[model samples]
Target: MKRTPLYDLHVELGGKLVDFAGWEMPVQYPLGIMGEHKQCREKAALFDVSHMGQVILRGENVGEKLEALCPQAFATLPKGKARYGFFTNEDGGIMDDLIVSNAGDHFFVVVNAALRHQDIPHMRAHLDEVEVTEIFDRALVAVQGPKAEDVVGALCPAARDLKFMETTVAPIDGVECRVSRLGYTGEDGYEISIPEDKAIEVTRALLAHEDCEPAGLGARDSLRLEAGLCLYGNDIDQSTSPIEANLAWAIQKRRKEEGGFPGAERIQRELAEGPARKLVGIKPDGRAPARQGVEVQNLQGHTIGQITSGGFGPTVGGPVAMGYVAAGHTEPGEQVNLIIRGKAQPARIVALPFVKQNYKR
Candidate 1:
């Protein structure tokens, strides 16, 4: 197991440690999950996401190579912009969901911490003449919330002008970094990539702002869930297809018509005819939370699906969850039952993103 550069800082802050993807990480701090969650929603929170893998691909034909490897068309991406896409297997199942950014002469990628090892090899196998460099000694930190813009803007004024899904190279206190105006919290935020040696300095600088507090994985999980974002291993995995996960928008219209990339045929078919099961949001009637792996049943007590992600939504003031249900029963407001601890808890289908997204356009 590995620890990120900020492990000492997390320990100093009294963060409760836990094992995540073979890395020693802080799950929560003394403020607890609920407090950290609120701080992020109300102000700004800093997350040490150094365990994630950052890789750069460079070559004359790197765009074409990436287009072949990913479901999204990288050739159309403009410089200083980022696009979210999935790496799919031959059967149309997702290997991982990653962000691809156009960094002038090279492409920058941020991959999930758990899939870093597998993803690197998979990506390298498809490259013919591209330079793949793993930035192993770098760390990623995200400053997220409504006030994030102002805090980050104070350090790097150029980043304030960046729109959602945009990236720019900027210097913060003499530390060069690639700053992206993107986050999983559905808020106005920036993800900064800094050298491992400067991780503490960058974190300290961000935390100096009165609105910024150090957040942990517990808050991140809740925030992403409230935003209806999927976790790699739980909500989406190799067995789940993009269409089945209700992520059809990830496949651009141009790519759909041109038909390139692996599993294009299967994905196109699903787009045309729809998938057997679809991911949808569910709102539990009472405070009893619905948890993952719980069976989803219809009014007649017949199981229709299983909950993939669920928890008490602080913003919503109730329990909210997402799961894959048979397509026929996925309509919003449809009556459903969640079998929680052998008790059939009544629930209803609802629109996703229980909390409204506040992304700055």
Candidate 2:
């Protein structure tokens, strides 16, 4: 498995390493997953996310050319602003979700590590007019929590001014880095892209803060789950359409009306008429966590859906899950049963975000 630049540091910090998306990543640390999860909720926690794929697109009409690949209105995207979007297949299925940032003359895209191999090639094939350049010289890290401002602001004051989803290039500890005010933990934070050689130094400096601690993948997954954020290949994939995944909010008004992107017809149809299924939050009745692939049945015991991502939410104090269910059963407060370990367990549908998002907006 490929190792990120922080492998040695993870070892030194007593991080439990595990294989994730072909990378040797830390699943948890000596602090434990539950502790790390709470630490991020209450204070600041740093994460090593260098394994994600980062790419840059150049040439004229970069955003316009990019619109052909996704449903976002990037043609009007202002500089220093980043927007979340995804690539769609001809059939309206989501290929992969990504974040695009307009950086002056170019656009920077960050994709999931596991799907980068396919996503990059897909972009090159469809966006032929744009100069697609994969960036391998930078490592990304995130410091997230209520106290994130104090931890990162002490090192770089410019970051304090950035609102949610805003980005900028600034010098921190004498190294210029791209700092974006966004994160996966549903907390106020920043994702910093640093030079590969200086990654360890920058990470160490951030960890040195009294309010910051090092968290791993275990806590990361639980955090996103509680935040109601979708995980690629799990909650969404090539077989899932954006509308079905409840991600229509990412599609802009102009793009929705013009119908120019791939599978625009199907998407427009879904917009006018809801999809057959909808992804919704699930909360089990007991302490037993209903994991992925578990069959979701209506009160009458008829299978209605399947759990995609499910786990114990440290903040929620119970098992939390998100899955696609028949449109009829998507309403909150609806009762359902989860087939866990061959037994039916009672559960209920709830509004998304088991926890409130703490973005600095």
* Candidate achieving the largest lDDT: 2
TM-score versus the correct structure, for each prediction: 0.98, 0.99
Q: TM-score for model 2?
A: 0.99
Off by over 4 Å in 2: none
True lDDT of residue 63, candidate 1? 72
Pairs in clash, predicted candidate 1: none
lDDT of each: 0.90, 0.94
Per-residue lDDT for 75-143 in model 1, tens only? 889999999998998888899999999999899999999999899998888888888888988899999
**Residue 118 of model 2: what lDDT?**
96
lDDT tens digits by residue: candidate 2, 297-328:
99898899999999999999999999999989
lDDT of 2: 0.94
